[model samples]
Target: MSAAERVPGQFTLVLHSHLPWLINHGRWPVGEEWLYQSWAHCYLPLQRILRRLADDGYTDQLSLGITPVLAAQLDDPAAVAGMYEWLADWQLRAMEAAIDDDPDRRASGHREYRAAAAALDDFAQHWQHGGSPAIRDLLSTSVMELLGGPLAHPFQPLLDPRLREFSLHEGLADAQLRWGTRPSGIWAPECAYTPGMESLYRDAGVSHFMVDGPTLHGDTALGRPVADSDVVAFGRDLTVSYRVWSPKSGYPGHGAYRDFHTYDHQTGFKPFRVTGKSVPPAAKKPYDPTLVDAAIDTHVDDFVACIRQRLIDESARLGRDALVVAAFDTELFGHWWHEGPIWLERVLRRLPEAGITVGTLATARRDGYVGDPVELADSSWGSGKDWRVWEGPQVAHLVQLNREVTDTALDSLDKRLPAHGSADPGADPRDLTADQILRETLMTVQSDWPFMVSKDTAAGYAQDRAYKHAHATREICTASDAGRDARAASLAAGWRRADNLFGALDARRLPTRDWSEK
Candidate 1:
């Protein structure tokens, strides 16, 4: 809209890739193995898009945050094994369909079989063969910037202090193991934050993080620098993000986009497009990806314009280049909205040509830009872009449990700190039992649980995850203090069996600095 903004500079585009650790777990209704589906549809295809861009000499400056739990599953031997098993199974299913007798049915089945076989093969080479190192190659390619977060995607404000520390430390360490090094920016698991959390980030070496625009109040359009710490907090440019996939009325809601729900019972494939806004699922058109590609181009153009405008206004208002970061769950591109990969490819490809400069979060901070904080209110990137999704009535039990378990862990850890005031320096003070319970507690407190429950997707599993972890966290804190080591150990072991995730969380990896150099 303005000539000043067009004087080509840098803008940040951060995308968060996260999923509950559903490796060999979660089935059917709630689970749907969104992981591999997301990988095939979104992750691998998106990676290919980035590769294509790189090939054309257009390296990505886009920021990508992958949660540690998700990372762990990505790097796990079990998960890798399971993925291949699933792919082979899919190949077999496709073969069966290809041999169907009916003419029309056979043609459809043959087409699907070919697509499935292609996807399975792509996944093998792109991800499975080399493991997560392939992901590291992408990040290291100068085409993309990577971000990390807590071990599990937890509701941070309501997590045990020890768990928070443990998770972040282990999470960052896991990133180093898989993708080759630590990330200077973190996604902060659902964009959940509290007053003191920034200090933890400072302690852990994270210099930047992102939150929804509403969380920073209605004032700022771009990311702002926070007080008490140097960590820059980027806010999601929702107006742009929603152009492709908003909850109610984004392009994905159009008649031509693929339907996330309503899978073909016989093939476990979603064979239709939205085809109608208010129409029932039974009456949708067959999904034609070709039509969706044309729609993506139009929507993507509008998004670039929106970001360019935001950068112009913010740079002038804040007296420097301002970053307009549009963040979203990585799953949306392919897993949730079937044609998301197409939209993503179109957006990324069109950015440079549109004269919109995209840079990584770390690069944005390094290049010098800051926002004076007026105030930051409670918020999130949820339905209203607020906390209601995690605190609403549909998740009241989760709310109560979060409060009790988190507060209990905090109080217990506080009391234990005094004992370490003069303790031996080399002692293993990392509370393993507390850490384990807190890990489960943190994993269970993921905002996804409440959101999933609210949306009625396996509400019971969500409830059970939250409550069971809350119980373990509370019981461990109580039992440990009472010298009930046996009971504490029993509870910790039990929770590990049920809420197990990120087995690589060795206590040795915890960062020891308080407020010094991260």
Candidate 2:
């Protein structure tokens, strides 16, 4: 630690890695294909970068939140098999492009071929069993702090308190089961929070969580304890974070970087650089890796300078040491922005050199970077920094469906099962039926469907998923209610083959409550 590298404040890079349960759903555009793409482009490459840094003796590089549902998919046998096939196909496509008549296409093909081959080799070495081994190794080596979230990534603000607690408990437990240690902090789904959510955090043993800056009224210079709880809330410093990627502008939009939207239909690869925002895909230049080095170098320097300046400015503004947390979706790195991993590595390396302290959310809290408690209102990191994205008029039906399914699930489970923690842990047929019902019910209320519908991105798929899960929950519950135990068990077994996840989830954990009080 050099004196020149000392800063008055700390900066934490938080990346929330999440995706809904996609296996046994659809395949292309929005399902298993989505999982395989992210696995190759984002998860594989991202882990390799962290492993390299860890091998070089870097620890606490960032906070990574892998939601329970996403982890389930990553560790699933079917997904692992599908990912290997996808990588093989990717290599074949690169080979086909390498033989193309167009010079540019051939060059791009060669580059992709090497990339695909390397990815396949890496998967075979580190991820053949499942993502858990690699992820577990990362945690064990202290490469990054793992932040857990609720099962299925439900939008907590709009969810019932009972289900929210169950999800959080099981979600953290799932992380422990996979990684051998439970996470004390979480990247709350969407960074969504209501006034009383902190108490739930306290109850779940969560020490901290992230939220958007506006949710804290932009006084994001320090972490604040929500309400009177010791559980702290860290706000994303938009000024520093959005400088890399935002709704309209970012380094990825630079003409020299590979464009995310322009794809070679034949090869299923993005083959063009972002020549200009107005340029059509046909007019865009072929992607050239040679141009990316300079872009990454320039952007990394700019980002390092920005973080240095922000730390200095924030410390002076508050007349005390400060904190700047920059959070983003983990997929935004290699998946959305081709050179993002390169830029991220450079930024993380340079910030410490530039006298800007870099650490995780856990480090910030443990080091006493917390401020006074705040009574946070209903909020999320979505459009308008509120809950409209999940509860808006456009998705009114979903909001209603979430409520109805949650209530129905509780009622049905309570009538059949003993009180919480009282049921036997054996694999009884009725217990399996209850588990499937609760699983589908949880899937129905996941926040992704409404978000996709509201954003008009894959709205059809989103609606279909929500309805499918809801209908499954209702059908199973109907059989159980009508004393058709055999039918209920059969449906549950069928669903389990497809939706099997969260082996720790049991209906016994969901406490039976008296509805008359409500």
Candidate 3:
């Protein structure tokens, strides 16, 4: 078929990349390791794929949401240095594994050694400086539309209105500083939303954001502008998204796929395939990279077919060209499912060949695929399609904790620092103290804590992080109140160095008054 005679619908691949501020916090099994693993396995490889596409002249082929918190870590000098060391150590570990006693272990070790070496080479070549340069290059080429989010990945629904507005503006400013262009789209953290947030997004210069499929009452074939707001909310096409990864089953569950849960104890490498659902990790079959190649091919075919059929069906139903947005967490690609990057590359390349118009969310909007306006209820991408995960009985305390911390941080900042329009604008000591308090407060209100607690995954560590940030906020505020400027400065500097994600944050820009009053 000629390009002009192809299907009428468009397909958008949206990947939300995020991780909480984990630098200088903890190392193995939970904190910095998570960052390094995702960086090495997901970010580096994904960018490599995108760069190849860009080299071939793919423009706005996909939309990538890099939350401000994640971007800060990627651009941090200390984090970059640490990641280099981690990659070097990974190479060494692979070398040791190649000399193991068992034949299967040795074979797996050799394979991993090659991968580790390649990753090291890639890091030195493209990422030795920091991730910002590479990310900026991608944006410049227009290979992908960058989607920026709030300062920290806070649950916007439960956060105070003033703090929410502040985070949105600051987050966009950070992205603009790094990329030299402000994003018109965002992947709202967790795809969570409340009524009236669209106006805030419009005010912040965001033209579009995402929510879950069910959030649109299961009619997610096209983007819908919320009531009386030009800012559009794109609903994730769950039918198409779950084909790649879902809670119950998906391509990542294939028997030939590397088992994410099964790892070589000594080498810290995943050495086995999923093998069987009931099989123990020790009993699982050894991983074979060759087997995964065939599986990726099959999954790629399956996924492309699914997307093609969905677009056709939805276009027919809508009586016009429709849009199918398949959104997922970026980490799921190379971090959770080892073959995900390969599958992604194949699917992206194959879709265009099949005569499907593949483009980013921005392209979809610009092409006039928006549907009738709708008033969306409060919802999220979590289970139940509501706020139960972050606000349920299991995480009620965290909800309250977020409230208290936000209130305290804003109240203290107002009391100690000059108001927004005050004349004392040039490098005041009060501004420094207030900035630290706001930083700690933002860190404390990250949505990861309640999410981890609700899922019972690393509950202890999540609780510790939340309490740690909250305590830092309280201590710094207390010192400032007592006129202990030196002590407060010391505490603030230490916390800043420890969890310094957003270096561009300035407390003076935060709204001192409520949004309602404005």
Q: How well does model 2 score by local distance difference test? A: 0.89
lDDT of 1: 0.71
Task: TM-score winner between 2 and 3, please give it.
Answer: 2
Report the lDDT tens digits of candidate 3 across residue range 89-146.
9888878888989888788878887988899899999987788888988988989999
lDDT (CA) per prediction: 0.71, 0.89, 0.89
Which candidate number has the best TM-score?
2
Q: Tell me the tens digit of each residue's lDDT in model 1 across 194-311.
A: 7778789998898888888778764445456676677778777666666666657887787888787766777776777888888788787777757876777777787777767776
Shift in Å, residue 300, candidate 1 = 3.3
Worst 10 residues of 3 by lDDT: 421-430
Backbone clash pairs for candidate 1 read 60-143, 255-275, 333-340
Winner on lDDT between 1 and 2 is 2
Output the TM-score of candidate 2.
0.97
- The clash tally of candidate 1 reads 3
**Candidate 3 Cα lDDT to native:** 0.89
